[model samples]
Target: MLNIPLMSNNISEEDKEVLADFIRTSDRFTNGPKVREFEEAWSQWLGVKHSLFVNSGASANYMTMAVLRELYGPGEVIVPPIAWSSDISSVFAAGFTPVFVDVDMSTLAMNEDEILSHITDRTRAVLLTHVLGLNGLSQRLLDELDRRGIPLIEDVCESHGTTMNGKKCGTFGLASNFSFYYAHHMSTIEGGVICTNNDRVYQMCRMFRSHGMVRELTDEDMKREYAEKYPDLRPEFLFAVPGYNMRGTELNAVLGLNQLKRLDGNNARRVENFKLYVKNLDPEKYFTDFRMDGQVNYAFIVLLRQASREKFERLTELLRSENVEFRRGTAGGGNLARQPFVRKRLPDFDPSTLKNTDFIHFYGLYTGNYPSLEKEKILELCKLLNRV
Candidate 1:
């Protein structure tokens, strides 16, 4: 562990071999066997009925929304402001309007109470995120949603190996999403998977993942004149709804499966590092661990007691000089929303829409955590941060 940087480079020889093996075989990029293998592994691991692979976490988000629009169109969905930029846009892309809500300060997840206040006759679902693996809000929010009979789609992208009260994190909601991004707990190089217990969602999502094509045709359609002419066509791949070309490649899935096999062990190591940070660092006056339920610690973070731009930059510079790399913990409204394109598209959008997210935008700072981070590196990070 050289002075801990944002994240250690994490592709191993084994992962490389897996990727190479997959590509050397099918290499067709689309409808490849490795994608199914990866999706199936995720489906079994998450205890969900179905899973679909996509190019990226953002692609998964947009696909989820696109599918949702087909079933439940033009409805209001509740989302926390403290989320990835793409998470917010998927709402608009799917023809639904996002009703941003404040988040609980501790969990940084959707504030159920605030959600209740925002819900109207138009409310259809809650796109909930288990922010930074803090899951205390999940059960309460789920209970509220149930009481109101509203549906929920979980964003478990940040909390893949996390759990609450012995139950897995992604299993609580109807449809849950996970990402195997380069910087995430697992590395697929670049890929995402959506999980669901519902048959309808599973059915719809398959078409959504593949450019809205009807992929699995029924016997009636296959027997018709269309079936005899096109042997290469799949009935299921047909477009049922307006969807994106969000299919995953075999290479990515092969890499992901290999990485997925080690997900638990990696999470455990990060937790060990998390405890080291807690035991060695002063918690009462400096930073708090956010008291998470089962954090994977993808990005070990803390909220500072004070917020000063100058101090923030100074600390960043100090860490940089020490050869430590870090990043401001992502706030809900990503740089995407603040970008010129989003601003113009949402010109009349109300500034009052996102409030709880503003706090995290400035106060949160995260040290990188990846499978490559060694014990020595974490210790070095602790020593450097404490020196300040």
Candidate 2:
């Protein structure tokens, strides 16, 4: 019964018309030419050498981890404690241990210095999520990871169109994941993409997306090697690695192609809406000074200046009474360490280690900020939030 929702379907009627036209005109639908076309278009847009269309953002994450595991065997992966469950789960699923780090209060992203201190010889990669469309990366962080010969995997699922130093967020990492769910900056119904400059990683992702078939790989030498290794097996069905069928459909690609055209424009609108929201917010009650350099606005995140259980309860009640739909925590099932999935696995895990993450877990909330949201609506939302 909420009047204001956390997400409005981003897919436009024009995009729907494109889908209808595609369905009527196209002969093949699932994982075909349109998917490849969309992947190429996305790679060009993100300034990456290659991109793979997948079933979901989580699948892109898991597939990236799987490919990395294949390249370098299981080891410890440094991850932010305040990320989506899949960011950590993918590490475990790929047989790697997740080493959690606290986040910076301002950016709500991993503390760069803390991440450096946490790295060890066993560290295979550093999986960083650009929390809620904010660029969490710094030159110092990238230089250190490079110096240490550690791979940087970026979870840019919530950060489409975000940039750092004139470079797109997804382009900086060894591999980056993006989502095109109905609620994201753009929509493909239910799809995601993995972007990478590494040819080996790109080829691996292609094979991984389609049941590990060698036919999907573009490297002729690698395909020949696999063919020779399994002469008895059918060449088309040659399984090069253990992988999942995480392919996206042509229908989804059609939506993505149309939606991608509007992503930047929509992002700009969202950014303007965020500025208005922040300007009108009551600073005494909320933490409004978010780091904005190289940031692309996603949601209207409101973090309380002080954390209190009673205040949080009151805020939620106020929001409910005002018919404002909001998510209690930030991105990806907030403060992942506090989730039951992680707590049960690491029974003795101390939540105090991630104080900033804990603060967000208890105090943070976010509402919708889309291109369709008018400036007046944003002002109203700010007024409502200030009253809380």
Question: TM-score: which candidate is best?
Answer: 2
Q: Each prediction's TM-score against the native?
A: 0.87, 0.97
Q: Kindly list the per-residue Cα lDDT of model 1 for residues 239-356, writing each as its tens digit.
A: 4567677877767777887888888888888777776765665464346646555766667665555666776666667777876666675544332345454566668765445554
Q: lDDT (CA) for every model shown?
A: 0.71, 0.88
Residues 107-188, candidate 2, lDDT per residue (tens digit)? 8899999999999999999999998888899999999999999999999998898888989999988999998888888889
Query: Cα RMSDs of all predictions?
Result: 3.8, 1.5
Instruction: List clash counts for every candidate, in order.
Output: 21, 0
lDDT at 259 for candidate 1? 85
Worst 10 residues of 1 by lDDT: 216-225
Candidate 2: where is the Cα deviation over 4 Å? none
